[model samples]
Target: MKSGFPSTSPFRLPPWAIRLARRQQNSMAGAADRMRFVIQLALTNVTAQTGGPFGAAVFETKTGRLIAIGVNVVEPTNCSLAHAEVVALANAHANLKQFDLSAPGMPKLTLVTSCEPCAMCYGAILWSGVRNVVCAARGSDAAAIGFDEAPKPKNWVATLEDRGISVTRDLCRDEAIAAFQRYQQTDGRIYNARKGLT
Candidate 1:
């Protein structure tokens, strides 16, 4: 909504938008449970169109809905990987102030974006003392994510896994698009990314 313009936060979507997001990722069963919990008390809501070059949508998971705090859509034309990384941190910091993370009943912040958060962003999240992060976008089809200016194979899930966050890749990557379409039903596709949700 909001003309799909770049803003600190997107317009509070109507019930239909929520339904649409759910339907779009319906095949994702785990997401259903996760979404149910995150949607309950969304003090804030945002969506990031950061799926291109160096952009990301940050989400803070709450009781029943994920709060879209800030988006890191830094373009390569304007900056480098290093600059993008700093921007991510600043976005997260500003988000904390908006939600008053220090207050009681503060909703858990979940960064839902198009790409894996760079190392600096990860550090900022850790420093912010928020743990619930959900990255909604997929990585580049050809390149792996890295902290360095130049990406390398060494920077994969291992980097985050070693930090203790349970890593789960969506079925979108390995599973073919047709395979993804096969599990569709009225409510949507039966999404089962590594099982655990009904």
Candidate 2:
């Protein structure tokens, strides 16, 4: 490891990427690398079951590739939208840099999560300046789940645009539902305050 840090291999930092990372370090909630590692860890834990109802996804910013990694299963519930938000925030956090606008290579970051994030997560991502997010839900055909305390749809849409992160969603229904069900069977649980709003 370099300087007691794990190497980010196959994902080298270009000149601009380094600059952007430095700039990002000056602002934001946590170190970009640390946030990204946490997101990956979280996603891994969420998708450990072979037949779980909940699913985790990984987003590639440069290519907009959204891949499913794990799932937490339920009895055919709706949770795609929540998955989308999580991927977006995780991706934005991963892509945080010091000077992306001036970075030469234009290399991108990715976000992966079990489900979409809540409205609050979206706002934080927007404010953080992430521009693209790709997500996968629990089920290929899973509909969006609503929370009793979640924000209105209209507000979510507006704020998403305000943050300037373009979103793309994909369906892997069988795997998603299987994941959710698996989770329930194995007693897997995930909870967050800002998980289903935007």
Query: How many clashing residue pairs appear in each of the predictions shown?
Result: 22, 51
TM-score of 1: 0.41
Worst 10 residues of 1 by lDDT: 40-49
Q: What's the true lDDT of residue 26 in model 2?
A: 22
lDDT of 1 at 43: 15
The lDDT for every candidate, in the order shown, is 0.34, 0.36
TM-score of 2: 0.43
How well is each residue in 51-106 modelled by candidate 2, as lDDT tens digits?
22332333345443332122222212344333333333333334333223223454
Candidate 1 residue lDDT tens string, 1-198: 111112342222234334433443222225434432222212111222221223222343443332232222233123232222234334444544443432465644444333345444555545543444454324442133221322333554565556544344442233212211221211221222224542
Q: After superposition, how far is residue 78 of candidate 2 from its true place, in Å?
A: 26
Candidate 2 residue 9 C-alpha distance from true site, Å? 16
Model 1 Cα RMSD, Å?
12.4
